[model samples]
Target: MTAPDDLLRGVEATLFAATEPLRADEISRHLGGADVRPALAALTEHYAGRGIHLVERGGRWHFQTAPDLAHLLRREKEDVRRLSRAATEALAIIAYHEPVSRAEIEAIRGVQTAKGTLDVLMEAGWVRIAGRREVPGRPTIYSTTPAFLTHFGLSSRGDLPGIGELRAAGLLDPVDEAYAVLTGSGEDAADDGDEDGAGAD
Candidate 1:
């Protein structure tokens, strides 16, 4: 029960020629009203363990070099642009509570979010302008983009890590950890021996 050879070839060619990933309907339209599911599945199976993998990320199908072979294709070292603490916090807030306005982000962060912080996230393609909120001022709102899910290897927002996972990973701030301990909500954090006079400051 394999797909037709011509259909598979068309799908493969379309994906390879695409500058970006395409949705199933887009692929179907490109192939002139053909149901491309079988072709895609067959291609996925055929490309398994090959130099390039036919993968679906964020509901868009595209071919990418196999993970193990990626380094071999790199001609030079990539410039690593590390995110600042402000940008990281803003990204997390956008991911967790999307379609949020700038005011909302600031309110949750308890600090004024600098425009540059969000500009970096947008430049990275993880955050996007969702639209203006429906209010008197109509403050601009933001949301995580499909690129965010793809980069994070998440199928959807529901796949984001939970608070318990963050706590277990020691990502929760000291303030939250202390409150958890005080309320008997979590285990005590370990002393890394650098805290002898830490509170003295």
Candidate 2:
């Protein structure tokens, strides 16, 4: 039988070489189908007080800098581009009510969503054209990508903060009020545009 030490070593090695976080099943498959849950639990405890700790995000596990000590490794300068308010609202709407058409987005926002706003999200690799809605004109629907989950540290869409949580965080506003309409109906609406004009492939 492979000892716990050996299992721990395998898990550590696999994670260190991985480009992305891995779930326990993925780690197990890489380790020849060994049950790795015990090994993972032990490793998580072992790294509890370390500068680098084993952390889980979005149902995947990886190593991350200790939150308290992270500032020690920060660079003096970093270029940060802030998202426009329209882009932010659009992203939130897509995330919460995905596979949504531009018309639906406009309806929810109560304003015309600029093509450039969606363009920026696509360029960032966070959103994608899911498919055309099964409605008149078949308007293209937009959805959040896996990159969105990874970038936002969400395990899944369900992991997004609830309305109460958003309100607690002071993030709820008049725009968010429109979200109730999304939950109430399943209508697929059309928008004026072609695939090229949509800006996302």
Candidate 3:
């Protein structure tokens, strides 16, 4: 029988060599039926204080730089591509109210959502087509992807900040005040307005 240390080494090597994150069952199978839970737990604890951390995201396990230490390894460069206001607003809407249709998004924003806005988010791998809503015309619904959570350093959608938190962080716009009122009461205001028609360049 392989010792505990040997088991940990095997799991470590497998994870290190993987191009993508691996599930625990996959790790167990790789070791020819070795029980990997304890080894994984041990490895997680062992790496807790290290520069790199073993973390599980979207049910897959991988190593990531320690949050505070990550700045040290980042290369400074100009970020030429930035999300447009429309895209940013759409993304926030999806993150907060997932599996929502484009029409629903527009209803919340009180403006017709541009196709390119969703396109840009899909191209970024942050949003994906969840499925069709079981309504008339069956419009496609959108939801945030695992990559979205990973990019934002969130473990799940529940980790997203609430309205109060956003306000405290000064991340909310004045227009968001109206949004807060709408969403707070679980009611959508009348869209007696024109489509904003904003698009990403």
**Maximum-lDDT candidate:** 3
* Model 3 quality (TM-score): 0.77
Q: List runs of model 2 lying over 4 Å from the truth.
A: 78-81, 155-159, 167-201
Question: Mind giving the per-residue lDDT tens digits that candidate 2 earns over 1-201?
Answer: 288788899999999899988988999999999998888888889999998888776578888788799689877773253455566668778988898988888887777787787888888888999999998999989998766776665668877767787677566653453332222221221122311233332
- Pairs clashing in candidate 2? 58-155
Candidate 1: regions farther than 4 A off: 1-3, 73-80, 167-201
Per-residue lDDT of 96 in model 3: 83
Q: Which residue pairs collide, candidate 1?
A: none
lDDT by residue for model 3 over 141-182, one digit each (tens)?
999987777766777777766668768867665335434332
State model 3's lDDT.
0.77
Question: Model-by-model lDDT, in order?
Answer: 0.74, 0.74, 0.77
Report the Cα lDDT for residue 88, model 3: 65
lDDT of 1 by residue, 56-137 (tens): 8778888888889978987686336555445566677787788988778777767777777788789988899999988898
Among all windows of 10 consecutive residues in model 2, the one with the lowest summed lDDT is 182-191
- Which scores higher on TM-score, 1 or 2? 1
